[model samples]
Target chain A: MNLIKLAWRNIIHDPLTLFLNIILLTLGIGLINFILLLNTQLKDKFEKNLADIHMVVGAKGSPLQMILNSMYHIDAPTGNISIQEAKPFLREKHPLIDKSVPLSMGDSHKGYRIIGTDHTILEFYNAEIHAGELWNNLYDVTIGAEVAKALDLKLGSQFKSSHGFTDDVDLEHDHGTLTVVGVLKPTGSVIDQLILVSTESVWAVHDHDHEAHDHEGHEHGDHDHEEHENGHAHNDNEEHDHAHDHEGHDQHEHDHSHDDHEHDHEHDHSDPNHHHYGEIAPRRKVNDLSREHLLSQTEKDITSVLVRFKSKTNFQALNMPRNINENTDLQAASPAYEINRLYDMMGTGTKALQLLALLIAIVSAISIFVSLLNSLKRRKYELSLLRVMGGKPAKLLSLILLEGLILSLLGFFIGMIVSHLCMSAMGDSLYERYNYPFKAWIAHGKEGLLFTGTILLGLTAALLPAIMAYKTDIHSNLSEG
Target chain B: MLSTKNLSHSYKGTQAFNFPDLLCQPSETLLVIGQSGVGKSTLLHILAGILIPTKGEVLINDTSLYKQKTNALDTFRGQNIGMIFQKPHFVQAVSAVENLFLAQTMANKAKDTKRVHTLLDQLNISNRATAKTYQMSQGEQQRLSIARALVNNPKLILADEPTSALDDSNCNEVIQLLKHQAEAVNAALVIVTHDSRLKDIFPNQLELN
Candidate 1:
């Protein structure tokens, strides 16, 4: 039998102590590996999404909250600003601004926010059309790649937007159904998790409610006058087209493509042939949707604006954010500064966990040392017998050392597997809650260092006991037996 | 053949030991009988190459054992000499047969499972060959220890207090087994013991005073 076999037998013979030592070491090593996996992936995902966008302009509120709500889409928006308020920066040739794409967000479908944005938002993310054409008309929406995949949305799929970013559909805007016109390719950024639509569509859903009430009033007024005269009521309904022109509303009626929509509305009402001109009400509302509704489609507000400057080093670029913040109500937050503050906050907790894991490992190493030393003392006579049976001092030393290596190596492998299992389990819950893609099996560079360190600890722990075994006076020990 | 000349030793602040010259021919059983505190174990250790005596020349098969370097002496002892202690001790982790294998391995010899089994069968502990050494009865443990010592077919076998703790029946059986195994390998067997019961078993004797 080899020394390794002998060592293995000795370890298994006393299962309790070996198990205690291995379990202690496993907890320590597993925790260290857990921290390594989280820290590495967290840094990677944060850096990946923090590309090129330099500043966020929003209604005055928490800068970090605005960045999280706007850039990461995982927090509540600060508030919205008027289109007029953000217009100077949105222009093609503003002095300090290179590009300002406005984002209007309020409604969501299935907890995924539907962002009302121009096509330039696609350029900012460097997204391409994965399938179908871009939205060309109102009520047409484009889905991001991950959104399409996750929600199982396809081209021509229809869904109604909920009033806010929540799963509760109690406040759903069912006035119109949005058809999926396109799906954007995944850019591995926050864009992959959004639904894109035109800003006008945002207004269309909210504006329909007011216009529906106003059209009801107009329908009642004309119907009341016609029905009271009794005979002309039938003729008044036939003269509806003539009446529309005479009211100086012909331009508005001719400008709308609401013929199909009006037909559907008329079918819903029992006596609605006279309300054929209800289509004209909706047409007028679209024309004069008003700066009031446009300012905050529901609240005439956008969550935040992601801004890129003409030059980071430019003097105007430096002063522009302060100028906007002090003179106007908008606040500009740097993504870099906010994200660093975020890391510093999280780093402290992880560092503490890492230290605790290291301490556990050191204690386990001590356990291994004490166990080996204690066993050596108890087995002194046995070792001496081995020497008499033609065993050398080096051979006995090797046996002790091998026992230590087997214990620690087993602990290391089990610890690594446990750490990965924990990550995978936690990753599923995190993804379900936050839509954050966390891969569990990613091996960090420091894991190699951890493995080497553990094995070295095992060997070093055995070193002293092995030396004692080597120096045993075989004759004296054997004769004592 | 095995022989020792002018062997003596002195412990720190302890009385010195002066031992007689001794010789045993091939296939012969020599009994070195002594009382307690007579340094019989010390003499056995010095002869086994385990301890370097203050004055001694131990020659086995015409080669001087003590004339070699410490490591070389260990190697020579492993190949040519086998010693059994008073209470049979083993690497408790391994089986009886595996303990024999470990002996061969330590001696830097190729493993011989067949020889180990054969020796265990001859010693009448073949049934316990696969049992852990610690699980065996004391008599069985001693017999297995004997099998381990004889597995290598050494030139000389030294057994210290081989039957000191045994009853009459067990002591006679153990002495016969040692003599039978030693003669089978054509090696000289020297047993050091304080047990007076062994005086009648062997024809050759060396009495230490």
Candidate 2:
């Protein structure tokens, strides 16, 4: 205890020296803390996004980009597949399949990406509605948390689609405004920056010209009544008015068109019982045609599929995904595997930073040694006096060592503080750019052990100077006057 | 009870002193009077075991001081001997009391605060106990050095030119303090000096020519 007191006194006596040491230590620890926190946050984000999905089935492209788009919701999708091609797998009920969510991307609302998917995507994400219920009909929209915040959007808010990736230009369909039906709670995922609508809505906007083309085709043929009954030839002005009413007006139009088609087809038949049968046949044909159109649309294209496994295994179920990519026309990736590989590639820089911290600590120790050694010469007579007055060499040695230990511990404490402040400042930017959450700095477990180890190293570095003090010849040095 | 017989010493291959015989009994102040360069300092160093004699033995209470190991010699010096140099060499960074405490530590004893204060009082410098060594006047530093020397109550007191840097009054005060300390410990006092001012106070004196 006395030795410690002496050490502390020595440091307190020299504020400039102590401050310099603190600065060096703070810089070293600050760099280490920044790197460590960044690495932790990146790994956390990757792992969180990796959960719930087993594999990504996407268009043949960079497997990394496919995983990035499908799992992280960043980057453009390779392209989309028709629902028909996705239906066989969806119907197969394979235990391994779990559930499939179809994602169609290409449009943007403000700067956030627009995801056109079915209600199944919401269910897959277990997304909670913060404002209203899920969209039940085409054109109804739900927005993620960041999308709502950035665009100042809320439930019932209307927004037009932008031309490109930004909200700058007016597009061809800028006249159409999508009403937001719900706002999703923040999930700390890529979903947070997205605007999700029904897949048909996406097809509806892009295929509006197709609707006009169908109208022209119907006018040329005897299917003019069929076109009106199919609900494709509604007045453009009435469609605009119905779009403003978010209360199932579109569904009502479909039902009315079905009833009119049934009555017309039945009248065309001569026999009454034949009329009943003709009405049923038309309904079946219409249903079959719509189903076939949906199936054919999704057949050739798929951006990606996220696969979740039944058991914890490393690349065990990778074969099917790889084969799909190599044999079939779609690409697959394991997010966990790819992310681990990415961490491995990044580990070198982290290791180098750790090495630099170690090196700086060592240099600091040597500096302590040199400082004490130099002080020994100036204190020779004083030391001799202590010896002649009955101070044992061991006690003298301890006093010198105590001084070194004090300096190092002070430096370590200062360094830790510096690291904490720096990380807190950078945390917001990291979340903004990478969707990562920053945790508080706490020296527990391995970090605590490292801190203690550094202090011990500092103490050990004082051993040489202590030995020099112990070897000083008291009788000879004192009587030399 | 300190004695040396046929003691001789050299520094860097040059002879510094050759003392045929010397002795100082308990409670006695034996002044070794000598001219400059007559080996007063060298003899004092040899007697204090600071320098190893090349030709003879230095015995303190029948123990051969030169034959002991370095660490043992240090321990023996700290516990049994007190040294006063021509100039007071206290640790400049520490206070006078701390210097005294250092002396007690060297002897492996608890700091005797009361004794240190009393010794400083006797030397008329007790007020300077908390003063840094560098801040103390030369006379006060010299007196504090003497106090530090006596803090462990050593059995043998060795002083080399202890009054050389002091005025007559301060010299008299230091001589009285050293004499009182030696008598209090029942130890032998050996003072080596070129000045003959202290001649009348010592009944038995060794004159080296």
Which has the greatest TM-score?
1
The worst-scoring run of ten residues by lDDT in candidate 1 chain A lies at A264-273
- What C-alpha lDDT does candidate 1 achieve relative to the native structure? 0.75
Residue lDDT tens for model 2, A1-481 = 1456545755666677667666666666556655666666676678767757777776667777677777776556666553444554443355556666666665676556677665556655667889896665566788988788877987889876653344455442433357798999988766777788765455344333223223333222234233443444333343431222211223322334233322222111111111110000000101211323334443223334555555435454656677776777666677777677777877887888888977777777777777777777777876766665556678788878777777767776777777777777776665445534465474423466657876786678778888888887765576454
State model 2's lDDT: 0.65
lDDT of 1 at A164: 63
Superposed on all Cα atoms, the candidates' RMSDs to the truth, in angstroms, are 7.6, 10.2
True contacts kept of each: 0.69, 0.59
What's the DockQ for every one of the candidates? 0.66, 0.36
lDDT score for residue A417 of model 1: 93
In model 1, the Cα lDDT at residue A1 comes to 78
lDDT measured at residue B194 in model 1 versus the true structure, 0 to 100? 74
Q: Is the docking of candidate 1 incorrect, acceptable, medium or high quality?
A: medium
- In Å, residue A216's CA in model 2 sits off its true spot by 25
Residue-level lDDT tens digits of model 1 in A250-321: 222224322222222222211222232311112221333222333332223455677888787788787777
Query: Given candidate 1, what's the lDDT at residue A93?
Result: 69
